[model samples]
Target: MGGGGGDGRSKELERLWAERDELDARIRLLESELETSSAAPASPAGEDAAAAGVGDGGCVGGGGACQARPGLAHADSLPADMIYRYSRHLLLPDFGVEGQRKLSRSSILVVGAGGLGSPVALYLAACGVGVLGIVDGDDVELNNLHRQIIHQEAYIGRSKVKSAADTCRAINSSIKVVEHHHTLKPNNALEVVRKYDIVVDATDNLPTRYMISDCCVLLNKPLISGAALGLEGQLTVYHHNGSPCYRCLFPNPPPVAACQRCSDSGVLGVVPGVIGCLQALEAIKVASDVGEPLSGRMLLFDALSARIRIVKIRGSSPACTICAENSVFTQEDFQKFDYETFTQSPMSDKTAPSLKLLPESARITCTEYKGLIDKGEPHVLLDVRPAHHFQIVSLSRSLNIPLSDLEEKLPMLETSMKETLDASAASDKQPSLYVVCRRGNDSQSAVQLLREKGFHSAKDIVGGLQSWAHDVDPDFPAY
Candidate 1:
């Protein structure tokens, strides 16, 4: 019966894979159609010249000869389809035809298609932004689906840039959706950012945030930045209208330990959704030259308390290396800036770093531990992950002692060891002490602490529970 159940699950997985492949093929076909349509004959040379104000640093369109507002430069009159599609927006007094026209002329580059970028791209596409560029090098994964709403279950294992661009095109196929299926580094950031009127810093890491902000400042583009983690979110518009850049506020990077990501801290899906929507709001406001944007002010959101607050942040600093008048931080310097080294943290958080605090003798592989378990050896499996994580998933009979409380619970650990040794009728012999965590890093630290406390036999599982799931038991949940 168990074998039959496994076979059924395998077949279901195969079917899902086939469906995902079909969906991918359809998306590619749609993208090709869009490209072909875009390549069709351009407007008359006179019209092209009049609308040539895009990307050349003039207004969105309104070449010197054109009299229409920057928004209306696309055409003397709105198209019939555009009128019906954006009727609600055109009805607004503040953002009527003029606002819609500006939006239609503006271009925005969203630098991450994850949680924040998902909503920003979706709303911008729906609002008829003339050109939207998505930048991401990661492939979709099951874990990203919770907060990264732009990606579907079928998009898993596909490029995030392609998935997000496809969704945006689906929402508004009239607009131009540019897919930059690569991570933005210092070398390519300037070239990618210069083409857009505004840049959105939807990226999650510090290095990328600083990199994007610096790029915007160098290229004279406004930046809409948003971040969310653990039921909290923040939004700010940097480098706009004499506002301070990110470096003006944070001259020094925060400690690596303090920079928690959604993966580590766990974000409520709606938190980023709220912040990303606000980011879209700010981008629209700035793009249309309408209501005030959140420049030099930070919006803080606390989902747990259901509170939203906007606070004034510092103005641009004279000493700001990149944005100040007297500063010499040029495009050349920006191209060569080593953001990871400056921030002392990696630019991407795709994987946790492996820790090697102990010698080979002090760590055991999951496979070796499985051997001991199969032989019915009397041993204690100590899970050093937090209590909540242990509750989520843990090996049977493993004791939970969070790494934070391990030192305080030394006596408890001693008692548990004593009990295990007595049960094995080997009280005189040292009890085997094996430590584990979600990953191997914390377990290594826990083992180091135990050894210092004279628990000489303490050893950590090399890759912790992740390796156990990968090697010893594929059925175990990794997260």
Candidate 2:
């Protein structure tokens, strides 16, 4: 009886080994079939649109064709383990296990590491996203710390992208972080965006924002965009299949006079943080395929009053140059388009003059003005700030001329000059006029206005009195 039992056990072991070998052979055969099938001929357009239908609407990779099987919906239904793992998401009818898995598998790319990028990167990383990519070419500075919170005090001189990446990784090790230590431009935008499923626009400048929108629309990828000025912030999801793109709304950037930049108008520290987090939420919604995303609507937030407003965006414009021909996707089409010319602000010469206008030639900073003053250079310094600011802080030998009162006050300067001329009985010398304001932006406009009125030797303080007070005399009071 013992001999018979031993023989039966040996036979059972042989059968199990035989079955394992057969399974290994089958796997190898399936891999070979996938390789051959993926190498099949491509369609004329270079994009494998035919391959788009594979794998139950999920992206298919390699040679094995994704076969649609019946009961796939049931297969995607919540399992015991999945339900337990994603219990929090399962509580919401809109976000079940399937939606959670979709989010877990999606990748997103965020451009810039400044104000808008900070909240977008932090929230996305903390939300269990599978992968996150950051692109930035700037270094952290003492001034940037006011709004850019991702970088710590120790990382003041470090690269912004690297510092941001470190913060994201520290939040979630499961998230794959890719850092690009360069600016995102036309030459590299498409290539960089192609690797990710979604793009988030956190860049401040107009050129980079336009480039990101165009690339996303062309590639048929979704983009979550946000921008802030003063206390107001704007948020939108652009380039989704059914939604209008960034160009569809604006068509072109606003005229220079109407355009407001952070440099010109100061932004509240928490304003961007509020707006950027909304952008991150929009991105997560797109990834999860759950709830109503901000695809066709713009959300505006006023931090000071705590108000939220929504603006609905209609379909794409028939005259849109970027989305009209779907011209943004292919490298050839993007190459043919002139981005530099496209992003250039409309010529301000054609528009009516405001309080002051900045000419195209001046590039002076406030630091330069202080040096000139210290050297006892024979130049006239004009304070273009409001009377309150001037009364609070004024440099020695500087004349108070508010930008708003410039036209009315010009005659007074001329009258004073005439008196000086009569007393001295000498010819009038062209006194070099240097303009300054709270920040350097308005001073440039003041200088340009002076030039238009025949003050040819006018100059602008680069960073205004703020830089002057910080660099020249720390004891001076700052407004």
Candidate 3:
């Protein structure tokens, strides 16, 4: 019986050895597979960053203290406080612990701290995004309070980034907030944009919008964009897997005359607030992979009618400079386009056919013009600004004939100037016909038009009313 037992044990040992040999072969195969994979061509850096656990979409590096982690990884690693804090997110069936985990790893960069940036920063921080970066170069001004609610009167004259970051921290202290207190210029935009998983285009500047779009397309990141003016606003996303970029929507920026800044065209406070909060919703959806993003859809909001409309936007354009194969906007191509110059107000574009072309005799500084106004000089100050602006502020003795209506309303100007002309004949001159507008540009344009109409004495007020408020009268109200 003892000898039989020994034989049985020996047979068992042999069987075990056979299994061990088979396991070793499997291990060798896996090692070979891993080696092959390691040797294969790597994916794009942005893709690699995301794959490495950066986030649903996040940049893993800008060469500082950032270590790229899989945003979706380590679902079991949540701290007790984290679990408690994110219990609301965890309660959702579609977005529970997994979604919370993704948000904890996600990073976002918001490119403005004004009206749109306010709600975006606030909501993203409250949602517990892992990292938040705010880029702005403006100071908190009195005018910002109406719609830029994140900034307070206490923060007036403070840097917008600092003020915004303070508000974000007050709402949620667990997240990291980075203050990029300078403007997002063309040169630094790509570098800054590549370091975040998602970018929020809260900027109103056209060049900055294109800059953000180009960088996101190049980096393979997502963009949540928003804009509001008057009673209307638009919200959309771009460069998220398959979608049209801004250039696909607008290949070229509108001419300066067609452009309307928030300052130039008054915006309803709720209009921007609505668009900004929607921007936050899109960003969170992107970060947590929760809902359908606005990649191929644009949300148009009409505050006047209180209606929201979602419309389909066309897909990528083959001719698109940034989103197409062999696209025109390469890393090198960005350098060729002058975003700095493009974003400046039309007054600064420098394409102005010499002020000299309008003639030195056809222009007067605000001081010289102020002197004529004070001396009761019989001159007709033709305020060629639009009717709306004329209503905002106007000289006591000026006529409002908008530039678009200037040619048609020549009779109105002639009738008004007849008295000045008759009085000037007694003094051997006519009340100098002076053209004025918000800035000096439209006034200059008006002066040229007048000259073409045989009213050669028409001269543009240098710097227009803005210069008037700045140089001539300290108390003259200016927008």
Candidate 4:
């Protein structure tokens, strides 16, 4: 009886497998039907230009001038590859052939090819945007690989735009990827922004974000902005019809010390990935006119709680300083604006006077510090990096007291050194305290603070461990 039951169960399993295969076949058929049904592409404003034999950059009649070929706006003549590629988009009523054609004609400029730009560029390229312009002056770093997914391990030292363009091209060879491998200062912001139909503020810096927003508003182009730091991210569309610019939402930046950067606070790789993809989706909605844009609304995402909420914002802010009728930034301002100096705190600023006040003797070079350690000289090496980083790869001779907690733990630092440190030293001048941080910037600040607290002999290791990795020890981990 048991043998008979086993045979019967096996036959039932076979029937279920056969049913699954049938459903899979039906899915393929439906996908093909959607593709063929939407084979008819609408004639966009650019179609007339292609028919008129306009040069790639010549007049495209009503759709402005063509940047590449007027290969967009395919009316009833969608390329065979495109039909297969955009099958899913074609199936959706919101983004059928008409929407795809619009996307094909649209050009978007993505600023800051970093964390947020990674997923945004990927999705937009794969979805078939005709032209993608990436602007970034920074180079890819070992630390950036965690969230900046577009750049790979091999691209550690390459310009971010070059790496980003390479990745986007590999994803979709049909689109044109332009690399602006220079900083977008006020001098060049207008020249670059005026060419694109839309701007994506993938930048994290306040100066660049404000610059991009102001430029888009001046050019009457829509802006899709997104930001992710730590586990939280925010997204919104700005400068659309009756929509408020970024200045309307944030007139001033948060205090620099209070502002949290991913380098300091840390970020889950997936957090920015999620926000970037959403930015792409909203940009697509604006470009293709498929759904209501995020203009006049902001989406807040909390990765910890896995929650997303959309809050309404005023379409126009009467008190908005920049976008208001009588505020600031006329079209000419884009040309003469001193964005670099205006937004950046000069090195001569009061807050950064540590290097000025601290004598040259208070800072030791990485090579000098290495010699001290080699001679078994008694000294306290205080690492002012985050505790998690110390756990990853740290010097055995160093003690971790993150810069933020250093002041409160000063007593611990002093007592620990007095009791146990420099035990084998020949002479006792009370071992000098030496500070180090990721890049030497924070280490200088810590040393300055220690000097003020009467640790006159305390000094910072110049260029921190980064210099050590470069000059003294190649095996020292950088990131």
Cα RMSD (Å) per model?
10.3, 11.3, 15.5, 10.4
Tell me how far the alpha carbon of residue 162 in candidate 2 is from the true structure, in angstroms, after superposition.
0.7
Task: Give per-residue lDDT, candidate 3, residue 461.
Answer: 89
lDDT (CA) for every model shown? Answer: 0.84, 0.71, 0.79, 0.77
Higher-ranked by lDDT: 1 or 2? 1
Regions of model 1 farther than 4 Å from truth: 1-75
**Clashing residue pairs, candidate 4?**
none
TM-score between candidate 2 and the true structure: 0.69
- TM-score of each prediction: 0.85, 0.69, 0.80, 0.78
Worst 10 residues of 1 by lDDT: 57-66
User: Candidate 2 — which residues are off by over 4 angstroms?
Assistant: 1-87, 325-330, 345-380, 386-394, 411-434, 437-479
Looking at model 1, the pairs that clash are 71-101, 71-102
**In what order do the candidates fall by lDDT, top score first?**
1, 3, 4, 2
Better of 3 and 4 by TM-score: 3
| Highest-scoring model, lDDT | 1
Q: Per-residue alpha-carbon lDDT of model 1 for 1-479, expressed as tens digits?
A: 68999999999999999999666545544543443345445445223322323312112222111122234335446654567788999999999988987787778899999999999999998887777889998999999898899999999999999999999878876676789989999999988887788888898899999999999989888999999989899999999998999999998999999998877778889888999999999999999999999998999999989999999998999999889999889999999999999988787875446879999999999999999999877788899999999889999899999999999998989999888988886567767999999878999999999999999899999988989999999999977
**In candidate 3, what residue range of length 10 has the lowest lDDT sum?**
57-66
Q: What is the lDDT of residue 174 in candidate 1?
A: 62
Write one digit per residue (lDDT tens) for candidate 4, span 418-440. 86555745545677788988767
Q: How close is candidate 1 to the true structure, as a TM-score?
A: 0.85
As for lDDT, the candidate ahead, 2 or 4, is 4
